[model samples]
Every structure is written in structure tokens, then in C-alpha cells.
Target: MKITFITVGKTEDAYLKEGIEKYVKRLKHYTRLELVDIPELKNTKALTEEQQKSKEAELILKKVTSQDHLILLDENGLEFTSVQFANYINKRSVTSSANLIFVVGGPYGFDQSVYARANDKISLSRMTFSHQMVRLFFVEQLYRAYSIIKGEPYHHQ
Candidate 1:
């Protein structure tokens, strides 16, 4: 199955962008992988936190399709080991109705509507990281998962 990462905002740091690109390229060898960036809301200085989240949610939801299996990268979500994540991806490839879509929300996190729309949630770690940094981490993890699935030498216990 194709895997898509949808995240809010752009990765401004050149180093982080390069890291994300590297992992994305590696992951493409295993699946149809793509990164979709939703532009950050403009002039958010006057908007409330809730308003900002809701606005961001609107842009995020527009990228989603009815056939997509939506998974949110949430702090409070389920945490998986590398092997388990690979198995989870395998199951989705065998059984999911559409492309597997994972989302990383804006700084203030996701809105209630976005939460309600997700089919599942995953957490990379308990410690919080910058939203831009998370992109690199998640893409690397995706590559790791695929490597594990194929019994490649890239990942080890």
C-alpha cells in the first residue's frame, strides 16, 4: 500500500529538510511514499488557540480522501516497538481499504474534529519534539519499519 505523511507547516531548517528527504527516498524503495505539507495559518497572532487549531484542521482535512486510512501522530496515542510497527504496516497493506495516511498536526495539536476522523493514532515517543523534527523522525521510522519487514540489515534488535 502507498504511505503518505501529511503534516502542517513547512520545514524551514535546511538540515531537517535534508534528513527528511533522505528517509523519504529510502522509504520509496519499499512503498509509494510521499510527504504532503499543509501551509501554516497566517496572522495567527490574533486568533485563539482553538481558532488556530480549527483553521489548521480545515486545511488538513481537505487533503484527506474518503478512501484513506487516517492515522494521527498524537502524544497520547499507542506506542509500538519497531517490529510491531512493521507488522502493523504489513496488516494495513494486506487489509486496508485505501492508502495508509499518517498525519502530524500543528504545534497546539489537533482539533476535536480531526481527532474524531482518525482511525488510529501512534506516538513516536513520550518526549515532545518540534513538529518539524517529528517529520524526520517519522520518516526514518517508516524506513526502519520497511527494512524490518523485509529482513534487511538496516534495523537490529
Candidate 2:
């Protein structure tokens, strides 16, 4: 199955951008991976945070399909260890899902509509992270998960 990471906004810092690219490239050795960046909403001075989430949700939903398994990365989601994450990946690999989509929402988080469409939610940590920093962290965790699955030395018990 293809794994797609859909995130809102651009990675402005050069270091974070470079790190994200590195893991995205490393992930190719395991399976199909695609990274989609949804442009941030403009003229948000008039819109409330809820309205912004609603608009971003519309854009996010457009990239999803019924056949895809949608997982959202949110602070309140389930937290998994590296080995457990590898198991999660292994489980999805055998499924009929055409694509496994993991979304990292905007600064204000996702809309209620977006939550309704998600199959599962995962939390990288109990503490919060910047949306841009989460991209690098998530990708690296994905790579680490793959390494654990492959019996590589990247992840220790």
C-alpha cells in the first residue's frame, strides 16, 4: 500500500526541509511514499480558528478517497512505541487499502468534519509540537518503524 503524508503549509526552515527530504528518500526502500503539502489559507485575519479549520478540512478532504485509510496526527491521539508502530505498519501492509494517509493539520488543528472522516488518530508525544517540526519527526519515526520491521539496527529495544 502507498503511504501518503498530507500536511498543511510549507516547511520554511532549511534544516527541517532537508531532514524531511532525507527521510522521505529513505522511506522509498520500504514502500511507496508520497508527501503532499496543502497551501496555508490566506486572508485569515477575518476568519475564526474554527473557520480556518473548516477551510483546511475542505482541502484535506479533497485528497482523500473512501478506499484510503485516513489517520490523523493529533495531540490527543493514541501514542505508540517504535515497535508498536512497526506492527501497525505491518498490519496495514497486508490490507486492501490503496493508500494509507496520515495527516498533520494546521496550527489550530482539524475540523470536526475531518475528525469524522478519520479511521484512527496517533499522537507522537503527549507534549505539543510545531506543525513544521512534526513533519520531520513523523517522517523520521516512519523510517525508524520501517527499520524495526526489517530487523535493522536503527531502533533499539
Candidate 3:
């Protein structure tokens, strides 16, 4: 199954961009990875946070399909260990034929509409992270998950 990772905005910092690229390159060996960056909404100074999320949700939802198992990377979502995440990946690959689409929403987080459409939610950690940093962490954890699933040495425990 292909894994499509969708993020709200481009990774601007050079360091974060470099780190994301590193894992993305490594991920090619295990699965088909598609990276989609939805452009940030322009002139957000006027719009309320709720309105901003609603607009972002429209763009995010457009990329999704009925056959896709959409999982939102949300702060309030279920938390899992590296090994457990690997297991989650393993089970999904074995059981599901649909594409697995994971989304990281904009600054104010996912809109209620977006939440309503998601099939599942996963939290990287309870602590908050910058949008850019989450991109890198998610990819690295994904790569680590793949490595662990294959019984590779990347993850120690």
C-alpha cells in the first residue's frame, strides 16, 4: 500500500527541510511515499482561527478519496510506542488494500469538519511541536517504524 503524507505548509527552515528529505529518501526502499504540501493560506491576519481551519480543511479534504484510510496527526489522538507504531504499520499493510493517507493540519490544528472525516488519529507526543518540526519527527518515526517492522537495527527497543 502507498503512504501519502499530507502537510499544511511547506517546511521553511533549512534544517527541518534537510531532515525531512533524509527520511523521505530512506523511505523509498520500503514503500511508495508521496509528500503533499498544501500551500499556507495567504493574508491570514483578518480571518478568525476557526475560519482559517475551515479553509484549510477544504484544501486538505480535496486530496482525499473514499478509498483512502485517512489518519490525522492530532495532539489529542492515540499515542503509541515506536514498536507499536511498527505493528500498526504491519497490520495495515497486511489487512488493507486502500491507500493510507496521513495529514498534519495547519497552526490552529484540524477543523471539526476535518476531524469528522478522519478514519483515525495519531499523536506523536503529548508535548506540542512546531508545524515544521512535526514534519521531520513524523517522517523519522515513519522510517523508524518501517525499519522496526523489517526487524532492522534502527530501533533499539
Report the C-alpha lDDT of model 3 over 1-157, residue by residue, as the tens digit: 9999999989999999999999999999999999999999999999999999999999999999989999999989999999999999889999999899999999999999999999999999999999899999999999999999899999996
Candidate 2 C-alpha error for residue 125, in Å: 0.5
Better of 1 and 3 by lDDT: 3
Q: Across residues 18-131, which tens digit of lDDT does each residue of candidate 1 receive?
A: 998898888878999878999898899999999999999998899888889999999999999999999999899988759989999998999999999999999999999999
- Clashing pairs for model 1 are none
- Reference-based TM-score, model 3: 0.98
Worst 10 residues of 3 by lDDT: 148-157
The number of clashing residue pairs in model 1 is 0
Candidate 3 wrong stretches, greater than 4 Å: none
- Model 1, position 61, has a per-residue lDDT of 90
Which structure is stronger by lDDT: 2 or 3? 3
Per-prediction TM-score, please?
0.97, 0.97, 0.98
Query: All models: lDDT?
Result: 0.92, 0.94, 0.96
Model 3 global lDDT (CA atoms, 0 to 1): 0.96
Supply candidate 2's per-residue lDDT for 9: 96
Q: Cα lDDT for residue 58, model 1?
A: 91
lDDT for each residue of candidate 2 in 35-141, tens digit (9 for 90 to 100): 99999999999999999999999999999999999999999999999899999998888766568999999989999999999999999999988899999999999
